[model samples]
Target chain A: MNLIVAILSGAVVYAVSVLYAGIGETFTERSGVMNLGVEGIMLMGAMSGCVTAFHTRNLALAMLIVILTGAVLGLIFAFLTVTLQSDQTVCGMAMLILGTGLSGFLGEDIASKPINLKFTKIPLPVLSEIPIIGDILFNQNLLVYIMYLLLPLATFYIYKTRWGLKLRALGENPAVLDAAGENVFAMRYGYIVFGTTMMAISGAFVSLAQTNVWQEGMTAGKGWIAFALVAFSSWNPATLALGALLFGFISNLGSNLQIYLPGVPTEIFSAMPYVATIVVLIISTGNFRKKHTAEPAALAKAYDRESR
Target chain B: MSAMNKFRFEKREKQSALRTLIITAVSVLLALVCCGILIFSVGSKPLKVYETMLTQVFLSPTGIKNMLRSSLPLMFCGLGVALTFKMNLNNIGAEGQYAAGVIAGGAFVLFGPDIEGVPGMIITALCCFLGGAIWALICAIPKAYWGVNESITTLMMNYIALMILAYLCLGPWKMPRQNTGMTERIPRSMDIPEIMIGDIQISVGVFIGIIVAALIYCAYKYTTGGYQLTVISKSPKSAQYAGISIKKNILMVMSLSGGLAGLAGFMQYAGVAHRIVENMPNNAGYTAIVIAYLSRLNPFTVVVVSILFGGLQNSTAYVQSLGVPSQIATMMQGVIMIFVIAGDFFQRYRLVIAKEGKA
Candidate 1:
């Protein structure tokens, strides 16, 4: 029963974090920009959330502030890449370094000082008692629950809405969107800012609500995993959620199995998520090649109106 | 095609070189400004910190040796990273490859066939190179056959490799009865012998690095494979049409790249640390990437750039002696990378201010 609960909990956290980052990345990629800076942005957000919560002890406000901080940085990245037309890779890399360096420097100050910030936990009153399944699924933090709600809403918004249609069109061919009475640059900018903000919030969720402590390099490779999950899911928000859950399970399983399999060499188990990512990537891309799975056509390739 | 036309061509050449020089100067100045900001934050004079850093790296023979020793691995890693990068392949797994080398080299020292009073150093170094190259092949294989993105795959492999090293150091390979999470020291026979000229502790690794740099330069400039990579990077379709095998080149480039990084890994262990420990190589792979990119992927340039960065890093220890944080140098290194990437803009594209009528 405990093992089942652990698996469910692991899946939920993984799904939520992946969902947030995946949705946001989808928005950016859809607009013909790839934010390789996702990890860095998330790092900064994690630091901001931890530090804010440490000083103010207001978990809710800290979360809000961290998300907003992500939005602001995302806007800066968009401004450089979209407005100034800087090399997306270079700007993205710069944003990453800037985010990482600033956060690490700030984390030094936040460490050693304990805060009474609470980790997010289950809030459903009766649903928590349902069974082995309900106990695991329904008993996560309010923040994670919000992520569950956001996932379907994001899917609907991306696939159903007029704005979503314009966003996809912009990614496919910015000139067509520009000709069809929509501001291509503006839409791209909006998506980048919005996507990076969510990515940041996802990272902050780990530091503020999950761990409730500011650990240096604590996000580890979670950001990169989120980035890989985007590809594994093939640009679908819902499928990405599934992929994230799978990764989360892999990650949590390693930690949990430490006790059960003490002699198995903990480091080998620690490599599970990464090894899994590579395997998944190989499988997915291989499948794509085999079946001729059509990519978004303009994924990561910038569309220039004048050039076109 | 007259005399005036020739003068115009000469003028253009002078102007472009002048522009490059100015941009480089500004970037260095920006880096210094960042350093100054750090000094101020740490409650020290910027000039004093700079002076101490310079004196520490160049004035002291020990510091020079240390810098060269640190730079030896970087030289290889930088060249390897720069080589793949020229083909538009971002092989960020040099860190993993480096770690893999240490693990592979460590095996030789710990368990390799012991020949009668043999030079263990040569055997261990060869093992390090082979280990790094083989580990790099793991990343190369998938990229070659499976169409996998090498960047993320390599980066992910870094974590796995680090974990493996951690497991061995802390568990099965633990030095018997040691308090720390480190393997037992390799035998001194496996150590890279140092050449002492007065107070300097320069190892044979530096000499090897120079030779390797020269060889890599020759390979890139004169070899068909190097030319093929450059052509493929510019236009893969054209290369394919011209009958160059993409998969073969990818494998060869990645293997060679990994081999270089692996050698750096071995050098770090046999020359510097003398044992595989957690955090061995200490972000050297990552920083080497920055150096490689900054040098614009030229093998010869990688050597010059690595030495410069190495000097800056060496000076940091001196600056730290002034009661300031050692992390200040790392911050500076990060800032320099940003500027370096930004500098590429000036090289490739010229900024033009549009007039009011342009819109």
Candidate 2:
């Protein structure tokens, strides 16, 4: 029972971090922009958030700084990829390198010190009274509860809202969206910035809430896992949430197994999530039929008005 | 109508060499200025730091040797990356491939036959090449057959590769006398030979890297396979229409790329480190991507760019003396990449003022 509770709670915290990034990436991909710089953005967020929290001792201010940083970086990416029509893959790579380097350079001093302010688990009074599920859900940090709201809201926004329809349409066929007299470029810019802001928040959550300390490359490969989660979930926010949870569970299970089954190599456990991701990616993309797959048709292509 | 006219961008038929050089210089200059601002913000004198880096890296013999040593792996990895980039296959798995190579080549030195000299090195090189090729095939096969995103697959594989490398180093292959996460050192006979010119000593691996670059340049410019790769990269549909097999090309290019990266790892181990340890590759594979891009995937140009980047990396130690963090080098690399990528746009298209009645 204790193991089950531990696993469930661990999974939730882990899921919240990736879920934020997954949802952000889902939105960006839905608008046909694939930002491979999520890892770098997360690092930037973690560093900035930790530094802000270290000085000001305010969690909210740290998060706000993360969002602002994400917005600025996203704007730079959008300008290069969308406005200048540069190769998205190369641009994303450049962003990743830039983010990682800059964050490491800036966070050198703070990495050695731990921030005082960190997000603590906020238990809801009424919700905390429920059985196993309540403890797992309500006993999580504030961001976890926010994530619960975000998943459904994102779903409804993506499926039901007019803007959401246009966003999906932008990914599938930007020319059609342009023909409908909508500004495709502006929509992409907005989604990219909003999505990356979420990615930054996810990073902040890792350093400020999950670990409660600053470290270089603290996000590790969580951003990459989140990026993979977008594909694993087929660009659906609800599916992405479930995928994040599934990955988080696998991640938790590995660590738990390390404690319980001490004889087994820890490296095997460390390699599990990545190996599973590759297997899932293969299976998801292996299907022959196009209709079964929910990949954005114009995922990495630059929209050129003149070319069309 | 005149009032309504605005500036427009015109695609150039061809960007002249002089124009490209100018644009590249401007981009690099702009990146330096941006990095200078960052250095200033951190309360450091940017010019003093730059001067120290330049003198310590280029003006000193010891610095030049260190720079050349660092450039060896980068040149090899850069050429490897360039191979995949030529086919538009984003194989960011060079880091993993490098590790795989070290494992394969290092394993040969540690546990293989007690052979000595040229025969031993040849066998080690072959083993490393095969290891890298096989590691890269993990992603290439899926990408070729199922259209799996190579970028993500390759990136994920890197973690798995590193984990496996770590497991081996810390477990089975660990040196018997030490508890550190490192493997047994290779025998003295297995060490790669170095050449001495006056007071400077350079490894044979550097020459190998140059030879590989020249060979790749010839292959890319003058071979049928290169032509097929170019066609496939430009438009896979056209390549398919031309009876070129996309799957075969992907496997071929990816294998070659991985093999080269693996050779780089082998060089670093056999030529320099002489032991398999965690963090051996450091971020050479990632840095190689930047070198490949900055050189526009040209093999010869990759060699030149790698040397410059190598100098930047070597100067980190010198920069650290001025109270600047070593990460400043990495940050500068990132800045250079972003600026160069942005500058590439100008080479392809020229911004011009619109004239009345142009539309």
Candidate 3:
């Protein structure tokens, strides 16, 4: 019972980190823009957020810096893929390289140093006392709490509202939206910047809330896994949050299993998450499962109003 | 919104090679300037950093040799990446494939019969190629048959490959008496001879890379397989209509690409490291993507660009002495790739400034 509770609780820490990016990437993809550079942007956010916390010792300031860094990167991506008509894949790769290098170059001085003030787990007043479920779900940092709220809000925003319909239309066929007197270019830029900012916050979560120390290339394929989760969720924000926790549980199973099965090489356990990601990705996409995919119809295609 | 409307973009009818070259050059210069500013912002002298970086990488003997040495793997991986890229397939798992090659090739050297000279080299190369080809084929099946995204699957496989490598080094294959994750070194006979010119030694791997690139260049220009890939990439529907087996070609091309990257792992043992170690390829696989892009997927240009990019990586050590981070080279690569990607847009479209009333 103790071990099961321990595993379930430990899964939240892993799930929360990726949940931010997975949900963020879902939003970006839903808007018909594929941002493969989530890994890179997350690195930048980690660096800037770490540096900010070290200097100011203020979590709010660190988060602001993280969001700003993400915004600038998103603008660059939007300009390249949307305005300049560059290939989204190439541009995203460039963003990844740029983020990895730029963050490493700038964050060299601050790497590996722990910050004074990191986000601590805060139990809610009433919710914290509510049996086993509360212990596993509610006893998390501020970011986790925010995510709990953000996930549902995001789902409602993407599905239930008037703007949600427009957002969906922009992805399915921007021309149809344009024919309805809407600005496809401006809307893409908005959702892209907003989505990338979410990814940046995801990185800040790693540095400020989770690890409490800054490291180079620290997110360590969490961003990529988040990228996979976006697909696993079928591009739905609600399902994305759920998938993050499930993938988290699966990835953490390796580490937990190593305790019971000591003789087996740890690498086998460590590799479980990535191997599982591939299997899940294959299943979710098209083989031996439902042929359901929510991939945007106009995804990765540059919108040119002038061209037929 | 009104501000964005000030500029109009028109699609270019045809792409000009010279225009692309000029744009690429300008973008590189622009990225350099940005890096210079970044260096200055960090309290280091940008001019001093660049000067020492250039002198060390270009003029010093050790720097030049190191530059060439680094270029060896880049060339191999560059060729590998360029191959899949030409067919519009993104096989970013060269890092994992390189590891697979090393593990496979290293296993043969450790356990197989002790052969010497040319025959030894041939068998090692084949073993490495088979390893990479098989690893690539694992993911290719899903992509070819079921329309799975090759990019994500390949990237996911990289972590798994590294894990397998980690298991080998830390478990059964751990080097005797050393607590590190490294396999036993290959025999001295397996090492390729290096030609010494003055204080610099050039590994035969450089020549092999050039030869490989040349062979790839010829195959794409002259062979039926190359023509088929060209058709498949340009228009998949058209290729299907013409009876080109997309599934077979995807599997074949991906394995060939992985095999080339596998040879890069061979260069690690034969030319430099002499033992299969973790993080062997480093970011060479990732860097190869940028190199392939900058080279416009041309095999010949891939070599030249790899050497230059290799020099950039080599120069970082000199710059680091002056308080600049070694990551400056990596950062500069990101900047350069962004510029080149942006530069590609100019070739496809022409930007025009239009007055609002003109509409």
Candidate 4:
């Protein structure tokens, strides 16, 4: 019983980090832009968040810095892919390499040190007493709580709002949006910046809230996993949340199983999340019926108004 | 919005070779300027840093040898990446393929029959090539059959390959009496030979890489298969209309790409590391992507570009000596790529002042 609670709690922590990135990517893809630099951007966020928290001893300030860093990167991506009409995949690769290298170079001084400030878990009073559910969901850091609010709000905004319809329309058929006198470029830029900001905060959650220390490439491949989760969720915010939790559960299960099954190599467990991601990707995309899946039609393609 | 009306872009039908060269030079200069600003922020003189970097990487005997050594894997991986890029298949799984190559080559040396001399080298190389090709086929088969995105699948497979390698080195194949994750070294007899010219030693693997690059260049230029790949990359629908088999081409090109990358892993293991250590292929696969792009996917150009990139990599030690982080090389590579990609825009379109009647 104790071990179950521990695993559940660990799963939530893992879920929250990826959940932030998954949600952000969902928005970006919905706007018909595929940003493959999530891993590199997350590394930048981790390094920036750790450095700010270490220097200012202010978690709020660190969070803001991380978000700003993500926005700056998004601006560059938008200029290249949206404005200059460069290849999205190549641009994303460049961003990933740049972000990874810059983070390592800039964070070298503080890589060895731990931040003095960290986001502490704030347990709700009445919810804390609600059996197993309370301990796993309510006993998380402030970032998790923010995510809880953001997930539902994002779902509502994406489904119910006028802007959300326009965003989805842009991904499906930008020409149709253009025919309706909507600014395709501006809408894409807006969602892209917003999405990248969310991705950065996810990185901040890892360094400031989860680990409280900055390590080179600490985000590892979580950025890639987040990307896979976006595909698994089929571009829906609510389904994305669920997918994040599933991946988190699988990720935590690996470590937990390692303790119970000592004979098995830990590498197998470490690789579970990635293996699951690939399998899920193949299954989700393998279907021949285009109507069944929710992949953005314009995903990874450059939009040009004059070409058509 | 008002500022956007000042200029408009006009598409160029074709870019002259001289114009392409000039634009490329400008991109490199722009990238240097950006890095210079970064260096300035870090309190270092960019000119002095660059001079020392160049001198250490090209002028010194030790630097030249190290550059050649690093260039081997980059050349191999670059050639592999170039093949896929030519076919418009984004196969970023070179990293995984490289790891699989090391594992296969290592397995042959450790568990296979105790053969000596040239036949043993032949067997090990074949096994490594097969390992990489098989690893790549995991993604290739799916993509060819289902139209699945190879980029994400290939990237995800990298982690799986690395995990398999980690398991082997840490568990079953671990070197005796060592706590580290590394396999036993291959016998000296099985090691790839190196030629010493005066004081500098150059691995024969470098020559192999160049030979492979030349062969690929020939294949791309002179073969019917190459012409089919070009058509497919330009327009898959057109290729289908022309009766070119898209599935067969995807499988063929991807396998060749993977095979080349696997050979890179074999080179790293047999010529450089001599063991399947944890950090054996260290970002060579990723670096090769940059080399492939910078060289415009030309196999011969890949060789020249790989040498340049190899020199930058070898200069990490010199940069670290001046208190600059070695990651400066990585950062510079990224910056250069960004600028070059952005510059490619100018090759296709030219900016002109908008006419009064234009929107």
Which regions of candidate 2 deviate over 4 angstroms?
A289-292, B1-4, B197-200, B356-359
Tens-place lDDT digits, model 2, residues B1-359? 45545677889988698898899999999999999999988878999999998888977888878888888888888999999998899999999999888889878888898876788888998889888888999999999988888998888888888888888888898888887888877767778888889888777888888899889888878999988988998999999999999999999999999999999898888787888998777888899999999888889889989988989988888888788877987899999999998999999899888766775
lDDT of each: 0.77, 0.88, 0.86, 0.86
What's each prediction's clash count? 0, 0, 0, 0
TM-score of predicted chain B, candidate 1? 0.88
Listed per model, the TM-scores of chain A against the true chain A are 0.95, 0.97, 0.96, 0.97
lDDT of 3 by residue, B1-359 (tens): 67776886778898788898899999889888988999998889999988997888977888888888888878888899999988888898998888898888988898888886778988998999888888888889999988888888888888888878877877788888988888887788889778998789888888888899889887878999888888999999999999999999999999998998889889887888888886787888889998999999999899989988888888887788899976888898998888777777778878889888763
Q: What lDDT score is found at residue A239 in candidate 4?
A: 86
Of the pair 1 and 3, which is ahead by DockQ? 3
Query: Each model: TM-score of chain B?
Result: 0.88, 0.95, 0.94, 0.93
TM-score of model 4 (CA atoms) = 0.96
1 versus 2: better DockQ goes to:
2
- How far residue A107's Cα lies from its native spot in candidate 1, in Å, is 1.3
Ranking by TM-score: 2, 3, 4, 1
lDDT of 4 by residue, B1-359 (tens): 65687787889988798898899999999999999888777777888889998888887788888888888888988999989988888888898998888889888888999985778888888888888888899999989988778988888888888888888888789999999999988777878898999988888887888888888877777999878888899999999999999999999988888888888888877777788987677778788888899888988889988888988888888888777876888889888999999999999999888766575
Q: Give the candidate order by descending DockQ.
A: 2, 3, 4, 1
Off by over 4 Å in 3: A287-292, B1-7, B196-200, B351-359
The local lDDT score (0 to 100) that residue B111 gets in candidate 2 is 89
Candidate 4 wrong stretches, greater than 4 Å: A288-292, B1-6, B196-201, B354-359
Show pairs that collide, candidate 1: none
